[model samples]
Target: MTMNERIVQPQALLSLIALRDRALQAESLNALAFSMANDLYPVLHFHQALVFAQRGEALELLCVSGLSKPSEDSPYLVWLRRASRWVASQLPDQQPHWLARDAVEPPAEIAEGWAEWWPAGLWCVPLQRHDGQRLGLLLFLLEQPPAEGLQQALSGLWQTWAYCWAALTRQRRLRRWWPSRRQALLALAVAGALLLIPVRQTALAPAEIVSHQAQIISSPIDGVVERMQVRPNQPVEAGTPLFSLNETTLRSRAEVLSKEVAVADAELMAASQRAFDNPQSKGELTLLNGRALQRRAELAAVEAQLKRTQVLSPRAGVAVFSDPNDWLGKPVVTGERILLVADPAQPVMLIQLPVADAIALEPGAAVTLFLTAYPLQPLKGEILETSYQAKASDDGVVAYRLLASVEGKPEHARLGLHGTAKLYGERVLLGYYLLRRPLAALRAWTGW
Candidate 1:
């Protein structure tokens, strides 16, 4: 049917007005075109809708509706692909126009395919803003010519819908792109102010409860452990037997030395009598006296070794050691460390600050210890002393040793209790406090 043969009804404007409202409310250009397609379904009698957005010199497909998705190699899809670029260039005047298969010519490459599968008619509406800027194109493909009333209704609202679509496109572009200069400057100012806020600089390290004046129990003489008198963590008094070394060899050596001392005394006494009888024997008596004195000194040394056989606690405290079986059969050399008998009354926090995380620590610096057993109740303390050099800790981590004395003596505080310590240093900006390590790492990586 020809365009002149069709007639438009006067009441069709009401339906067109309702459709325009729906299109205006859409969030994006794609949604507006999709909604328009659905609203015009009964009116225009179209089978498929295609929406495209203009990008530089090309028209990019944004949305498609009404028809089932065609296969990649379908003849209809092949025709559409071949014709999209030609259709984009045809709408140069930013006006809505209809194309008839009889009037428009197809490209030579897909001419046969278009003739076989293409729709009978296509209406192209250029989406243009109020300022006449062409945003994109919307196409409705029909199997046959639409009624005159539907055609006139679509023509009347097409420009209004274009303006709505153009507005939607502008809103979307603004959201997707970067912020304006003013917005960026405002954000940077807020961040700078936050970074300038002062905060306490703190360093975290692994810590444990240790004795301030722990008495070390060492082996005075080399001997095998015969027995352990005190259990680990057991309370003990001064002079309490901690562990005993084998005394059998020491007692025998002392007895032999005693016998030699008696023999030397008898020889010296006989020599003295002879010296009195004869003046020539006086030199022999002096030599005998010297020998006796040497023997007596040897006996005293042996006796001293016998006395050290029984290891005793030097001060009254808790016996801090591992398993009792560990010390039972252990042989130790002279001056070898046996165990520690820590005075529970004087407890200090021993911090193991890892070498990688070490910070400048001074005496009396604030320290907060959070014991594993008593995690909620943090104990307050201050740095007492720090080792001059780093040493290997129990867990094989190279750490600096730091001693801190807790302020209040809590009843639950016990020696050997493990905890974490947060040592506070000088105040610094919040940015430095948070990014201190990251900055250090970046500097090391860049070497500047």
Candidate 2:
């Protein structure tokens, strides 16, 4: 039948409408390509269909009839691509037309495979938008030439498919550039929920195990440290000798005073014996007695000071100090700290919280100590005291000194064990906990 006569058929009209609806309803370009290759058989009779989409200046195979997806390396596809490129180059107008092997000669390589892979007739359809942008090309391999009426029908269908392709392509581009409103809202809700999660505000600071009620062992007299009676961390009993000041000077002075007292006593005795015979000697007797008493007082003071040269631990505990060599031959003034006699069982955590990292810490706040020596076994503690003012710590950072009592005195707890302490403050939102430092830095930079 003629093209005009066939276009008037109700059944063909309904089929065209149905096909257009299917193209319009396609969710993606791949789905539309599949329908174009596989679903178009009812509208047009063909041995096979190949779909190609324009990527750049070249047409790439999107799908093929009778296959879920086309393999690019397949011999059939390889030859088809070359043939399609030659055909596409011939059609500058980007129009749809039928092709035959003899009508337009393809390259020898493409022509050589035409008889083996394709049918006698081929139809080329260029899928273009209303704005003249070429979307892709469609090819149909037919055993016999299509009727004039079929060509006219396909032209109308091409227009509908091209329009749908353009719409779907724009939709895809939009989807790529921006998420759908529903998806964006859902993501925002998830992020808000995550930000609202409650977490404990915490900070990490350098810490060490120290004696809670340690005895301060200081030099009792001004002298050079003669010796350390006990080693560092060594256990000592009450009244155990801890250290001693140099007693050589004090001892010599005591000896001199003792001799002076002896001399004064001999002089006084001689004067008392002489006083029995002469009145002048009686007057010297009082001066000799006074001199003897002064010597005795000086001797007693020297003896007392000599006894103080040796220091002893007043309580049973461990001696916490640096190397004995550090103190040996070291001159120390009176009341200078020598070493600590600490109760190892009552170990406390001493934290040096840097001023920059200091948070709102309160008494009884949580503290977790991970000692360098025993990191695997963490000890829990609570803040017992916090320094009212920030001072330069041993490492020279201005920090607030915090003292925390260990919850359970573990076996590894001992004086002078160094570690890192994690101190926790009031709970806050997870967002705040994560952004606290960053926000602080931002505020410092922007002053906002």
Candidate 3:
């Protein structure tokens, strides 16, 4: 007898007993399949083994012995794949296949490659449940076909292994995919309610404190600012001097007009006396009177202009200007803005909404502002007005201007104090509220 044949008699019986024990104790499908393949090594005289699992009407190679990943174009893989497909397509009445190199006719290229890499014969066993439902395929390589006695001994063992593998794999799949009935119902209920919930949509913009009703103080005539009577942000009463223009030129003209008025008065008196003494001089006196009146009117106009050179606050408020030096030496024209006399008690919000970040704004929309200086203390306000056209902001960005009135302004609130403002809009779904910007960006990208 051959040395291998003598050894297989006792080894085959021992391996069969070991396979039954290991299969019952295995925890996972991988462990069980790997153990079953290992236990059959001695009895089947196989060098390599592969396990494939059925997935959606096709077989997926799950585990391999002696390799990390198989190459797609390998000769042994190509032959094994064909054999697996043939077994998968078989009728229940057909038995499992034991293929030899000469029995199967494949492409010449595959045959040539296969001869160099693998043995001449292959054993393919179909894994199926007790009800005859196909699970997958088991593949092994051998030098030659097994003896009839050995095949008879392994036939029943193969059926038992298939049944165990199918049951373990199915149990694991069911546990992974199926949750408890209570958990499923709760998840569905939460999803339905979340889809129906409504939330307020908000847009953010930069804002600054501004006066609601501020009187703008400007120069009435063209002149250089000579002196400042009040400092920037200083409180002032009505008729208070904010800053005075260079009155040197205007005063000089007034002096000239005064001297001309005196000369006209003296001439007018002399002309009147002449009229009283002689009737011929009476016509001359009328002309002299006209000249005197014209000079007097010119003097009055000059005096009025002279008075306007001293700029004054029209109402009691705080002066708002950048710096005293900004206006002290600056030349101004008629009606050029110099400063703002704002009522400190009536500060409002001026928001600069960038064109890209702007949304639909309406009067009475709620707004919350968090100042950079005092981020923890938020100021509440409501939108009062919004500009239809965009204007250049102080920072050189094109933005829409919005006016808002504070609800309860603090005593420390001052004009030009900047903060971030959040404006609330119409209610919408929570999903829409969060995804509004992303959806807008997607639309812009797709141009739809």
Candidate 4:
């Protein structure tokens, strides 16, 4: 062996072992790359070091000596990448070698930037796994060539680094695939348990306050309403006149019948007086008398209809209806609902549950009402009854009507107070409770 090929000093050997230990102890590929580029300055005696790792079909610069992170867009780095690619292509044997500007002919672009960015001598080291797969490249710039013994030492040292690099790279790949497989499994188990939690099924619907035992007032006869005596929600006594219907037709009919009755009576009397002189007159007298009785009955019926034109309240309560103008001049049929005589103190909840939001509801189901007038102070009630058939509500949506009695007589609650009501049903899994509507919508859309 030549004199320059002698083994390194004991101190240098210790330093080499220490560097290998540090590289093996590195937690990540980045830490190892940092150590290879920066920590090797004291042992290798190089002016600058650039570390590159193989990424797919390209070489990616990982780090630079004395820089925590190298800017890939910098002019020097851009040029170095091109130079590294050219060097990587030339190294078919994947071995450590020395490079100089004049020793190897490079492409025109790489040759042009060599003098400005690099020194006279350059050492290229390709880091590879035991199976000969290229892992990374290390380019060390030197003002003077490294001794043959140090070169041999570096070759062995990098082999150890390649092994560590390959190990770290495999660990990094696993980390990218899944951060922690065990923790992910634990989270899935927790989520499954949470899905099984029991929760009560509930639905929201629009509700209103109405009287429990209210009297529905309807038209007694078919006539046009001429006037309304009491206003909406106005308090009144049992004998109070509620409204008056038009009496023009009834009065005219009564007057005509009265005149007809008088004429028939006069005919009957004249016939009776003539009956004494002629037999024909006596036969006409019976017909005249029957005609007079018929006219009188007709007049009595007309008078009775006239008395019915004036409507009166049957009970003492608040008159609940729309505006008085709605009734005035409007013709109504017999038994058509006009207003309601309801007791304000006996208030109950009326819920119009939409068909889409309807759930399994039973009598005496718990109901919580949030009144629009008194939103902060909610009222509690229980379902009394529910309509078996769905019908168009006042808002024009198909809904089922539900009646619920309030727990106590609340002074603040009155007729016509509207709000939202929450109805609770049987308990079910939390997953089912939350996914009920979504599942229903999905089924509707997919027809499944």
Candidate 5:
């Protein structure tokens, strides 16, 4: 009689025939589900409703209108469940449809007067498949009751919805597995790359390697370097003869002086005899005697000069030749230096300190040295002398010179074996380097 009656009246006859056709040749659910949700949105007063092809009871809530979900424990689900149970009982032989309180078959008074007299027109009818799966609910919330044609449409598509839900579940399972697998592979590749790379660093300290000042010796005398008595690096005691000059010229002069001395002795004897003979000749005799005596003294002076030909050592220790010893036959002039000897018992390490450290050091301050040749060994020494003034280096950096002594003949330690000595007068943690020092310097320089 009404539009609702027009939609629902033919459901019993039409649904039975449609079910048989679906059982015989079933299809995927997409078309049938779209028809249902599209038709239902207008009837239900809903803004949006998307049908999902998920198997079993995965969908949590049923909203007949807007986005409102009626909970499972609520009276709406109980009413829907009762209706579904009644429909499932007469399932194969009967068709599913919304029933009033006075249905001829299994009757359902569920959602009675839903839009007839109720304030909000809400009701739900559960749909089921022949295979005993809950296919979801047919939502019906409307301002007006459904047309009789609507029940025939709902009953027509249970089988198609079941097949589509199974497919969706399978796709969901696949999607969940892929992303984690991709991320795991990326992490493993990064770890492998890090392991293959290597790191290296310098083995030597930068500040420790530097050069200092030293001296060279030269020849001082005029005669030929007749012989070199000392070998290179050989130790010598103080006043030892390092080399000797030829004594030929001085020896000849001494022989002449000896003849003069003999003549003077005879002359002096004659003068004394004359004086004894004649008292009047005493003054002349005295003058002759004085001349002979003075001549004798000059002869003694010449003899002494001959003894100085042999060269003598000036100091005690090892000798380093300034030039090749093969040139020993070459002549040298007066005041020329032949060799030098130093104290072998104590050897010193010299370090050039930077301007800041140099200014801090004073004589008698303690220091320590560590040589590369004896890497694990440390030697103790003192600052015996410090340059009171600063000298600028070739790079324009100013520095002061420091000296430290090695304790013993260190194994593998030799003169000119390169090494370093730490001249520590202030205490600072080794970790604090550029930061603490540079900021302090900046502050001082800027007067900030």
Candidate 6:
């Protein structure tokens, strides 16, 4: 009752009363009601108060004040919860009630430091819906003696609290329903307008060419990049020499070893031929000839090292990315990315389009891309790629990435430039685009 003045203010009450309209959200009601209960409770007593919510729940803490959220969930509150459920279940009508008038006393088991606050009288009251359907219960636990007139005041305030709860809860349900109803009517009006107006819109579809995209390319081998020859935006042909590594020592040793290996191989072959003529010498040649094979293998290893000195391009593309800060003249290790060459002849557009809209992009669709850098120019691209792979954003929204290809050489276009595309796709009626996602989510949630 003490907190009732602020809680029952005209504005908040109106918000609550609006709940029954079948057009408001239950959360708004819950929030407003929680706020009122919070403001009202301290006026009554500072110990603590909670305006809990219910579903199948007899009551769940909707909001609380007076006790900082318990460092741990308070056991006393836990006891009240079980007891409330037991009591509500016993009633023929769904509502909260006096689960325990004095059946149990607060025990040390309830919370830490409980010995300081001994046995207290506790009670549970029902929070009923406007139609008198019970939604949850209200619990009151206090020192052994509730002060004079306190019981009366609480009882009087309980009705107001219940009204507030019912109004707010219903309003929540209404907010959602009303929007849906409005949308239905709006859709009808839109359909009517479409029938009356003569207009045609072109359809759009995504393109046929999509490429795998990666940034921050890594090197394939572990070696110091002795040299870096490519510059930013430098276009290189496939297998073009991009850089080289120091192989002076490796090459010279390889040549010397190769000559020795060739000599050994020649000697081994001569010995094998001689052994073939002497039938009993077969075993002798096997043991004496393996050195030639081993030496030849060593020579091949040197030759491979010589080849790795000249780093070659794996693909034909423009080296659009080479961080000067981390590049050439610097000692780089194997697997370090010296450069990134995106497929220049076949550059694809990457767009993170929302699923709601992306679903409309039919395969082989067309789109218009406009770049800010070239405001006067427009490019045609096709949606050749749509990935079903969706990722959840930090805020928990789902989105899919799409790839579209521009038709020709991109003049003044740069990688990662901010550009917008008006993608054309299937010609669905306008309302489907607006309503489908929400309707789908609702159906999934309700299973109806």
Each prediction's whole-model lDDT (CA): 0.80, 0.88, 0.80, 0.89, 0.53, 0.59
Tell me, by TM-score, which candidate is best.
1
Q: Give the alpha carbon lDDT tens digit for every residue of 321-405 in model 1.
A: 8887887878889989878988888989999999888767799999999999999989998888999899999899999999999
User: Evaluated with lDDT, which candidate comes out highest?
Assistant: 4
Candidate 3: C-alpha lDDT: 0.80
The TM-score, computed over Cα atoms with residue i paired to residue i, of candidate 1 is: 0.62
Tens digits of per-residue lDDT for model 3, 1-448: 7534754577557777777777777777777667755667766768677778877777877666665566877766867676556545643442456777888775676577558766887777777777877776777778877666667667777777777787788787787777679999999999878967898878889999989989898889889999989988899999998888888887888899888888988987887787777988888877888888998898898889888887788999999888887777888899999889999899899999998787777999999988888888888889999999999998999999999998875965678899999988888898776677899999999999
Candidate 5: where are CA atoms >4 Å away? 1-223, 236-241, 277-281, 312-316, 324-336, 351-357, 364-380, 387-401, 416-418, 427-448
Per-residue lDDT of model 6, residues 99-169, tens digit only: 23345443434432233432344344566656777655554554443443444444545565667667666
Q: Per-residue lDDT for 155-179 in model 2, tens only?
A: 7789988998899889877776667
Question: Which stretch of 10 consecutive residues in model 1 shows the poorest summed lDDT?
Answer: 2-11
Off by over 4 Å in 3: 1-197, 273-281, 430-448
RMSD of each: 8.0, 10.7, 9.4, 9.2, 25.9, 14.7
Deviation in Å, model 2, residue 75 alpha carbon = 39
Clashing pairs in model 3, backbone N/Cα/C closer than 3 A:
none
Cα misplacement distance, residue 305 of candidate 5 (Å): 3.5
For 392-431, candidate 4 gives per-residue lDDT tens digits of 9988999999999898878778899999999998889989
Backbone clash tally (model 2):
0
Name the 10 consecutive residues with the lowest summed lDDT in model 4. Answer: 1-10
Cα displacement (angstroms), candidate 1, residue 109, comes to 30
Q: Candidate 3, 335: how far from true, in Å?
A: 1.2
1 versus 2: better TM-score goes to: 1
